[model samples]
Target: MDSLKDVTLRPWPAPKKEELSQEDLLVKIEQLASERGHLRDITEKSLQEDIDAGKHIPDDTNDAVKQEAKEKEAPSRQERLEKVFNAGKEMYGHLEWAKFAATNALDLLSLVLSQDTNKRNLSTFSQTFREQGLNQGIPFGSFGISKENHEFHNRKPEELQRIQELEHKQKVVAQGARMEALDSAVDEILQAAKQLEKEVRRQTKYWQEIVAVSDQGWPLQRLRQNARHVPFGVRYGLPEAGDHFKARGFAPLQMDKDGSIILDPALALKPKTFRVRVSIDGKITGTSQLEVEVDTKDHSIQKSIQLARDSLFEEELYHEMSLETRQLLAYGVEFRDSVISVDAPLMGSTSHDRKLLIDCIPREDIVADSHHHEHDWLARNVAEALRLLLAHEHSMRLYRRSQSPPPLTARTQEQAPPPLLRTLLAVFRHLEGVDSLYVCLEMVANTLNSAGLEVTLDTTRETSWAILAESLKEPSKRGLSATDQLLEIFRKPFDGRATLTLPTSNGVQFESLTIVTRTIIGQPTFGTEHKLTLPSSLTSDLHLFQQLKFSSVKEVTSYLDWILPLHIAHRLLKSEYSSRATIKSHDSGITISSRECKRGSAFSTDIKVELLEGKLKATALTASPLSETEHTEQSHTWNGGHSSTSFKQVIQNWVG
Candidate 1:
């Protein structure tokens, strides 16, 4: 390691002769003594830090090791301070009678160290005991005085004086060694202080230049002007300008006249305000008023807001207006002009079954004749009537067990829904064209009214099944007869049943025969009511069949029918004669060969043959067959040529 180098140190706050007199210098010295103590503390802390950081090696505390360390450590401010004190004390003892060395030394040290500019010079110190040794230098063991043999404590007054003089001289020489460097350091400190002050001022000027440019970062002038048109939001300058201007050594002022806020450097600013604008796609749907206020009371910030209300609900209004207009336009467009698909058979079947799809709109001509209404009313009804007609056709198919019709176009967008009045007119026109159609409809209408049905329009599917069922409840003056007949007569195509009962003089007789059963096969509902209305018919025919109450006791499935008078006579005579007459055994098997028996035959000879199964079979010999046999007998007599003399033979020929 190199030994301590000769380092040049400068004084801080260089001292002036006028500024610090001897008395002031003494006070400064005392403060420097305290500063020395502070520096010593700092040095110790640095030494400890070095030791802890492994920068110092503590092997042993020998005198040689201590000396080596002291030399390695460069002089600090505390050491320089102490040197000044020691030099001043030496001079003070020579001048003053009293011992003012301590006071003087303190004064000189303060003056010197305070003026020092060198940081290295401000960090020095000395051992406390060594300086005391310099105050009293001669060794105590120098006189021949031993602790075991004390001789009047040895005369040492002159020896003490000699010791003090030598010590004082040594102290003086030590203080004089650094005197020239101290003087040079004072001048150096003064020069450096001037330069530092200049640097601080230059930096301040540089910052101010940078802040001036940054203050208008967002064009506050434009922001203020634009804010006037917005109706909302306050405009203010940037909040950071004050801090920035201060850093640059300039005071910034608020630009309140332009509505641009600026933080004042002179006064504490609570907070700054600024303007903002919100827009979408450049369309001005709304304008708002907004205020940003910073309360100086508690530095609280709040924004007040107000927005213009939209008075026109345009979206909903437009949609409603368009829908209504479109509906009206649709009325002019021709609809139902297209047949789509027609199933006449299905419609006919519905008539036969006496069921109409009341929900469906009737054909156009029929609708017009029925109502004679305005076109608009007719249009609405027509749509409904058509739907009902289609539905009736479909229901009839189900009733007759027929194959479903081909799919018709359900969506007729071009057609405005035909009105109810139109359908009624169309139906009336249709009825007028076909007599049978009128009769069918009248009967149905009558039957429906009589059945107490309640008619109501169904709007769901444009077709109404409701009217049919409901209309049936209306009263029918002719009862259900006309409807019953019409439904059955037209039902030939649908295979329906019919029953007829007629009154005889003796009894009431009836017959049920189905001309066509094909139609009713799938139409179970329509045929259900066809069940012999014998009860209803009989009830109506009470006066006509009142005499049948006394007829034969035999139970008859059809009470409406009884045997005729002629038929009854034939039945009685055959029964009586069969019991009394002889049983003529025929050539073949019990054949009645006598012709006299059949003369104006009031009775029928019914020969009943009973098989083993007890099932009786009957054959009747007619009066004409008996007469023919008699004629054959006469012809044989004539052929024999002896019949002229035989009276019996002649009689036989005449009888034949």
Candidate 2:
């Protein structure tokens, strides 16, 4: 940087004044100071001496500026007081004239605005002012002190009459102007009356329409701004909707030319509906119902509100599903080009695979996916379930807000969004998985019962739904109503269960097995799960320890097919034959060592029972030297056109 430019300092000299010594002001000040005894300077002495000697300085401090300032202070204050008094006199006179003028102006205005034309005029008003002695203190009018130079008395009669003529002409001109003003004021009054009458009619019509809208049961709210044509707004959206949708719910009910309410811009967008279609083998099987058709030209307030509300619901549903596609990448879910692709099979098998395609389309759009209506119920139920879940989410949003909020903190904890789509998926997965297993179990139990064995079977769709009536009989806690508590069901995991008892021990024994199906969308569980809990008697010798969990329905069924047969062969049959029947190898096999009726020989038969395809198969083999045919073996399968039979009968025929 260049050195800062040299700046020359300008000297401002003090003004010269005559010495005050000529007036003896300095001499008198010195005499007063001498009498008062000035403080002696101790600069030459040590600092200790200065401290020891207490000093006093005169009030003026022997400074010229201080003495001058002190002397000028008194005179300046006195002059200020005199100036204030004079100002008060002037202000008081002005105030009195202003008061009189205001009162007189008010009287004149009232006279001008009066219903009847006034007989008095401006000249009379001025004469009254002069009577009040206004001219003496204020500049009121042309009246003034008489002077000899003005010599009106010495003027000739002709000159005085001419002056009088001029004054009369001036009065005539002022009167004409006042008369014109009165005419203008009359015209204005007529115009104002017409406008007021029209305004009254318009206000009446607008209020009547507003009353109609309010009476329709739609909530009305006052608009703080934009009340020019529309003074109020309607709330049609769900209360616990997302913040953005919540804002879109309110719109000013602007009145149109016919005094009918028109839709606000926020509610005027093209209406759309959510479409959930079931596609099997690239063909549409079912679709959600479309909104009722509406006439565009005759769009009423109620219709518009309904359309906006439905559209908001569809949009939120689409948005939530879109958000879910990110977390469900492992489940073949994709959200591309604003379309959601997901699997929604009715059964847990690839043969019955179905794709659930979700999209939002204009309400008026047409789709004829009516070829196959078999899956239509499934699709419609899916759509309704999703809607119910969204509604449940809205209730939960309010419930969470009513509870005590977490303490304030700088570290932001992002609250998870409502699991509308996740819950829907869980519902589908859980129902399908549990129902499929239960159906197979019923088939197996029927086969065993038909073969002279008593097997008990029981199943429930949902535990909560099973005892819903009993639960509702009791009073609820908190401020939550029964409806809110009922809606709480969707927020938790869905549970389905089934129980079966072994055939050998009958219903009196504690040999039942429970298969519990649980489905949760997030956290530790990412899919449907099933757990088969066996009786402790059978699990003591097995790795199952009475409880085993499976992630899929197929796995749970396969494990049960292996465990149930093993349990029977080792626990039931071994105990029945007492030393004669021994478990050969472990899974689904046993041997009976007994003497034949005639030959008196020992023999062992191996039997294995299991599920094959959709059928049940029981195989038996006997190896003995007691009058038996070579390669003796018996096998039978049920559900594939074969006669149904139980494993116990096969075992008896082989070794007895």
Candidate 3:
């Protein structure tokens, strides 16, 4: 009874208005709708502003908007939602563009700074060398070799004349007729550097002003503090010490917690105590230590380190300059025994030697062959570095050329054909006669057969004609289908023999031939050699195959210098249908593949060609199989193939 004591309850608050007239209810509804509309407008504007500012919006905001639209079933609400999302996409695009521009600006600044430093160092080296009387010129004897035995020194007189002409042209432009051109170039570079610095300062100030006005603290100061951890010349975007440095005998000694690179002691060229003065905006800012080493009691440490660093920097600068200069001069330049020698072409036909002397500080004599050993390593390193740099330079040059508009002269000039196309055309012209064609085809078939791909020829010519027609529609089906068609025509195993009969004006004639040829084309495979029977008339053409054994694309072009028109033609054709063909090269050889296209409906064809032990080996793979009838038709068409004119057109459409 005590646990069941009565509990007090309070009634809920009465409704403000239980009932009202029609006019009052309408008025209340209108007021409520107006308030809701005002709130919706405020939220929409806020969200739009956030998106425009590249700020992330709360997911709940989106969910709430979507829920309101679902409840109201309003088409306008959905449309507004779409507009907001589109605005976000536009903001993202702007953000990406900003990032790209910033990155490129940093890279450009880094490159300019590095170049300035290098130029300054080079000027110092030249002054020091001139003062030391090292400019007398380097002699061939300094290279520990007789001048008469050197390849450049032994060049013909004609080559020497050509080299002189080239040198004169360069001197006219680079040194100027009055020696003012070099000065002008220098002034331009200096102006560019000043402009770059000014731009950076302007950008920094702009950001700083923004921070001040917004009362967001000094972001510039934060940036500067973070920048202190960045390596000199790398703050913007210089290449880091990595495999490239290591391969040149430089190794990392320590990696600081903040990611600073400390080179290995054994490989460091500069002494620990030696420092390079650094300046910014014409004022001394600080100093940079070139290396790290423990303190020593030896008093000559400073002198040794300074000499070493100077020598290294000079060598590197010279190497880079030589590569750049080579682009303007065709002469072969070599460095040996502190001497730089230029092998100029004499009279544009033969090479002649010219030398310049560079004086270097004598290294401490510790071992008998110490100087020789060190110089050898330096030379090797310079050579390798030059090779890589030149490759990169060439690639960039090509890219720039592609991006820029062509010069007026270039646009108006008639271009020459590629060597490969010219050579192919010449071959076709030489094999124009039916007898010649038959002999060549037999030889080609025998070569394929010997390489493990069986080949047969159509006796009736009908089957070959059909195959050729089908191949015209679908080039990819040509390889394997043609082979199958050849097999069907003979109806027997390939014996590397062919016979043909032709009706002359007066009587019928019989021609018999045996072909036993071996070709190295395609992927490497084991097989016995076949005795290739080339017609006596085609013996000279055999040299083409022999040359191809050692030929890369570039080598092939040079080797076929007499057939430049073909090469030019091939290049033009390749560019026109680049999407259908792919050509790749490696140390071993090149692989060329063609994709299936609408004209023909067969699979792709892949051909790999490489030189193996002085033999040109080629392996071809067909992507799909074909029926006997389709194969026969393709073979027949191939047999009746194109004339020289038509052949050229086909090549233009198909080859890359």
Candidate 4:
């Protein structure tokens, strides 16, 4: 019995969610929503049910409950009641009974009435207003007059039927046109599906072939500026070039209609190789033919990549040497007509001059000489070394890049290319000098050994190459690779050494002599130099303390030719004579004197000993006081390589 204003409304309790993490808050909120039904789900029916259940009823718990109880007890006044007003007859009712009675009365009237039209003048039926219009156009209030014509407004039934027939024909034409448009749309969809399928097939084939190429270890990269037919590029050229070359090292792999990769212009080009011919005295002693292994079918992707790689290396090698030729012109290295000619003088032969004839020829052009030349190995080695050096140059390029870069500057400095020709020339000069010296020393050592003198000799072509193994075992602090270090030696001066047993230094003594040869292509000290360092014992014996320097192998051998025999005579022969030998000229001569007395006569023998050209020579004079006929002279020559030839045997007969 509460009035509307006096009935106090109770508000629902909200969930308490403070000091909770988002996860905990979400869990707490969901738990609360499930425990207590949502406010939005509370309906009047639920509220009335709660009210009927005696919830929210006033007890003396708080002021809110006391106020609620007071309002419920005091709300006996009627307020805001429904069904207090009645419906009016003007706007609220439709007189269905009256309308039915009127309709029946009208129908009864029509059954007896006659209809008439102005078209037929009169008819036996009640008049119908179906063909009549009450519209008077303008000046008739509250309605607009249409200026346009209407189909059935003022027209007869026959005219309306004719218009309907014409509309039906027009509808048929429009339907036909709509069907044609739908057919065109369907054809377009089919064509688009076929085109998409073809494109898919093309894409699949292209990527498959690209994957195959990738599996072969070729580097592939996406193009920065995409080409029309090319999306990716293959890098088959040398990686050490690092864009240093003016031409790029990669080429776009274009797709053809069949989804095969098209060979770029770089790959389509022919390959080349070096033809290093060893020419001696104007004759080809040896020739190298570098043949490429390729498939007969050009469709092979591997073949194309191989050709491109070979062409890149061969072209770069030739170009580098061509540029190097400018600086090596003084060293007899000339590049003319794509050919490099290097002067390689022989060891002992002064008449015939050897030359290394290098030509950058196409692989197809080298027709493998019909006959194998005597120095075929030499020519092939030269070519191989040249190629290896180029590869080494590529490695050096990478090494240089790995180092810290210089500060950026506006003043650009032009860098010279790798010294390929200079290295080749330096190696040639160094080897030539050292080999000649070794050959001479070997010949002398053999001759001395044949004379029953203990002598041996050994030499190396280059010291750096000799110790390359030891150098590679340890890591370099400077971050230089062993191969780079090895290749780097060729760019600088070359050093070679040979050790030989000094003359008369038997196996019991380890006294030896050393010869160091050095060569450079250019600068303060040009060409090859040979320096001789004799053993300390031999140096003191021969009054020679300083190292001997020679500009030519001929000069070195000539000097050795004179010094070896002098050491043998001054030290070996003089000591062999015991107390009987007198050293009057210890430099190169020895004298041995002997005297004997018998009962009837006196005998005396005097011998002069000398060594020349690594051989022993002795001359003896015999005389007796008994007669002039006793005066006799005998000479003995002891050359090497003969057991019967002995200086002792000849000197003994002269004394007896």
Clashes of each: 85, 0, 61, 7
lDDT score for residue 444 of model 3 = 41
Could you estimate the TM-score for every candidate? 0.19, 0.69, 0.14, 0.66
* Least well predicted 10-residue stretch by lDDT in candidate 1: 303-312
Q: Which wins on TM-score, candidate 2 or candidate 3?
A: 2
Clash pairs for candidate 4: 1-75, 2-75, 114-125, 114-126, 115-125, 115-126, 115-127
lDDT score for candidate 4 against the true structure: 0.71
Q: How far is 439's C-alpha from truth in model 3 (Å)? A: 28
Candidate with best lDDT: 2
TM-score of 3: 0.14
Cα error, residue 509 of model 1, in Å, equals 8.4
Which consecutive 10 residues in model 2 have the weakest lDDT in total? 138-147
Whole-model lDDT values for every prediction? 0.31, 0.74, 0.36, 0.71
Model 2: per-residue Cα lDDT over 195-232, one tens digit each: 88877787788788778778877799997676777789
Evaluate model 3: give its lDDT.
0.36
**How far in Å is the alpha carbon of 60 misplaced in model 2?**
47
- Model 1, 139-162: lDDT tens digits are 322223224533345558899899
Off by over 4 Å in 4: 1-173, 242-246, 292-295, 366-373, 405-414, 477-493, 503-510, 575-587, 596-639, 647-656
Cα error, residue 88 of model 1, in Å, equals 50
Q: Give the higher-lDDT candidate: 2 or 3.
A: 2
lDDT of 4 by residue, 1-656 (tens): 22443666775655565355679868866755553434345678976887898775543465677688888876433432322222234213336556656765554344333222232222321233212211222111222233653334477899999999999999999999999999999999999999989888988999998999999999898886756569889988777763544255678899998788988887777677767888777878788876555553544876788777876787787778887788877788877776889887776578897898887777767455564489889888877788888888888777778898999999997878777777777877787788777877766776666556677788888887888788778756377777677777678788888988764533476678888888887775688888889887777767886698888888888777667766665677666656666667644555555544555565555566555454555666666567757767777655565656444455556654
What is the per-residue lDDT of model 3 for residues 264-328, given as tens digits with 9 covering 90 to 100?
35334532221122222222223222233344334332233334344444344344443334332
